[model samples]
Target: MEMKSAVAALAALAHEGRLNAFRLLVRAGRPGLPAGELARRLNVPPNTLSGNLTILSHAGLVEGRRAGKSVIYSARYGDMTRLLQFLMEDCCAGSSDICAPLRDVALACACEETEPS
Candidate 1:
């Protein structure tokens, strides 16, 4: 992603509620969740949730689709991976061990993705 897009995405996630909502959607994976369910779980009022969701969606962190009467929100996995790779792209500093643990965590997440939830 370009610097501007990355900055926008990061800025959107900087807020507490938005961050939490993003994380929750990430964990929810591609299946996502309805806006009402998300609001219910986050204890967010409808109006407030709408604004936060809009920010996240604009940031390319979240996606929503209409399913009958509800809107289901899901994390954009490709965008998320690109964001992470961008953040870590310049890392290592000649010490592979420094990032080994984080790589392991990334691998673990990959493994989880391969399995059925």
Candidate 2:
């Protein structure tokens, strides 16, 4: 990702509500969660969630598609990967220990899928 794009994505996630929403969406996986369910999960009002989702969508961190009456939102894995790569492209500078924990967290993201609430 370019510096500008990375900054946009990071800035969007800098807010507490947006960060939590993104993490939840990531855990919820590609099927994602409906707008109502996501807002309910975060205990935020729909309008607030709508605004947050808009920021996330604009940053290419999430995408929403209409399903029936609600929009189902999911994380954009490719953009996320690019952002991660941008941050870690020179990570550790060949030090295995320095990057190990980050690798572990990334691996756990794949292995640990939350059962829907």
The local distance difference test score of each candidate is 0.88, 0.91
Q: Which residue pairs of candidate 1 clash?
A: none
Compose the digit string of candidate 1's lDDT tens values, residues 1-117: 788989999999999999999989987877899999999999999889999999999989888999999999988878887888789988899999989999998877742443221
Q: Roughly what TM-score does model 2 have, to 2 decimal places?
A: 0.89
List, residue by residue over 38-65, the lDDT tens digit for candidate 2: 9999999999999999999999999999
Question: What lDDT is obtained when candidate 2 is compared to the true structure?
Answer: 0.91
| TM-score for all models, in order of appearance | 0.91, 0.89
The regions of model 2 sitting more than 4 angstroms off are 111-117
Clashes of 2: 0
